[model samples]
Target: MTTNLTQHFLLDPEVVFLNHGSFGACPRPVFEDYQRWQLKLERQPVEFLDSRRGLAANLRVARTALAAELGTDADSLAQVTNATTGLNIALQSLPLKPGDEILTTNHEYSALEKTLLFIARRTGAKIVTVEIALPLNSAEAFHDAVLAGFTDRTRLLFLSHITSPTALLFPIERLVAEARQRGIWSVIDGAHTPGHIPLDLDALGADFYSGNCHKWLMSPKGSAFLHVRPEWQAMIDPLVISHGWTADNKEPGVRGPFGASAFVDEVEMQGTRDPSPWLAVPSALAFRRDHDWWQVAAECSRLAQETAARVRDLFGLPALSAPSLSAPQMVAMPIPPCDPIAVHDALLRDYGIEIPVFEWQGHHIARLSCQGYNTREQMDLLVKALGELLGLEQPRRKLGQA
Candidate 1:
């Protein structure tokens, strides 16, 4: 049964929102928590803003909770604005030289690709993008495609935990292990992984991993975390430098407390900013516990699987990934020979459904995401709308006219 609590989100009431995989929807309770922190900061700028120690303490609490969730030490995890920012910290901090190659898959997010290109231009390094064939059938095929990218010049392996456009979950564990065995650095872009799927960073064994708390954890925007292994901590220099660099009381050249230096020292103090989103992470976790989000996930997964199956039956296209390999909460269904943009626009303008549709190397995919708020009636409506838009009812219409 769907809970009434799911109705508290701020998404448009008229539209069927299936794009929670993009920017997440925050519940009323978590939003209130975020506002409270903002109010506290506003009440006393001097006490809250001036005191680095106080802000750091609050940040410490949030980081501790996030670290516990990801299965890593608190010191190794730093609270960033989002997964992309954390990813930038890892990619930019790398001490790459000319001729070094950062290997990645062709299914990477466009923003991250631009970041890699920027790094390549600056350091004279090469970006190696290996293609993983679509309708990805097995883990062995993915592993082989990634391993084939490894070469003597390969210095780093950057891959997504869950690809953005394709909406397929990659088998990162095998790739991480292979990179470690070959003495190459592994950086995982886990923007969509944390809340959508189970995460055990320590067991996953990636050298650097970054994820968004806002997406799956139901936190407010700007809530994200970056996890770094102890050995690779020294390589990262924070994107911002403030009082963390030098002080009258502290010793010179001292990093902050988290890593070799403080995690906040390198990253946290980015001039005047709001820390409310980061501070409200714990409250988001509390909301999940209070509402039993695990059960919600299971229900959502069932709906996603059922919707995907119906779409597949209607289209007669092959399933992208097996049930066992992919999470039931999200599914990518192949669209038949049609203009992806045209079909996507028609769905939105005609049906009033909000879902993601895109092309991946000559194949069109209509990716649907099911959350607790979604209803079976909504899925039925979507199926009917898609069928009508795809001309699947052409014969029936002709018979009726006759």
Candidate 2:
């Protein structure tokens, strides 16, 4: 923590950026590499963007690096703009009929909730949402809550690896396995999980998983990957029809013009787009390796937990979960009754802290994110700012107290 890791990032020095869980801050080296890729593309547009030329081969190299980090085969992964797009591709492709059920939970990201609603309206499929109880203490509690939602009509199960609103980590391994046993397809939204936690997608056994490198991996924005098991890859259709897509895509082992499986080629080869962020992924991985980011992330998790506890005591608020059940580097603390927008604006205006304040399940939440660049002093600053803004002149009840 004494090494001043902030110097390596491109964030503004004036802002105490506690919003890494939102669009992440790219490190200097990775941003430079992203610019380098952009320069290369501009130098020769035809050679860089043409699938028959350097484009396809270059994309494969990036995918290989990401696949190794994700513990999946390169061919099973496809580069997309973000996890939302990836999940859209996976969800819309499913052959949902009238009366089929798409099972999910209450804590899913709002954008995805809209996506699910759209799909349900169009396909006449019903969305069965289960409520995950708060103050989570054990994995069994999560498993029990989710497993009870499954029914014979359930065809697809969608879940967030780390929830957005409450910032709690759902123990999805058991639920995914149970879904598989029930012959239900499992799709995971891993937007906050790529570098925040250790992942082994093949071992996880989810039918489809999508994550954002731009969030936790510290890559440039608009970089993410979707992984599909080989058996299910043929069923995935690209969001856009492009040259790489073929009508005979249902035939297995069919390689596109890029020499990768039809699944990867179709999802990745959309119309002209900047591939710089995707190509810069290897540099982001390298940066993490060189910095020993695992150790830094551990420190960050400790800081996040300690800070959340302090905030909880300040507001007399109960915890959403135990430390083990929460996100490693992001903690959403329940704040005293207040307008979320006013608190959010006051923090930025009165203090230079950048954080997210919103309502979840009728409770106002102040979500804090800790990255390698954050310091103990910054966390203290945030606590001081909140106390003053909310008029918490005296500490309230302790975290576990009723």
Candidate 1 residues 40-73, lDDT tens each? 8999877787545387778778888888877877
lDDT per residue as tens, model 2, 1-402: 444599899899989999999999999999999999999999998889997888898999999999999888999999999999999999999999899999999999999999999999999999999998888889999889888998899999999999999899999999899999999999999999999999999999999999999999999999999999899988999989997787776445778767888899899888899999999999999999999999999889998999999998887889999898999999999888777777787788768889999988887899999999999999999998888777544322211112
TM-score of each: 0.92, 0.96
- Against the unseen true structure, what C-alpha lDDT does each candidate score? 0.82, 0.91
Checking candidate 2 for backbone clashes, the offending pairs are: none
Error of 1 at 344 (Å): 3.0
Model 2: residues with Cα > 4 Å off, grouped in runs: 249-252, 392-402
Cα lDDT, model 1, residue 388: 82
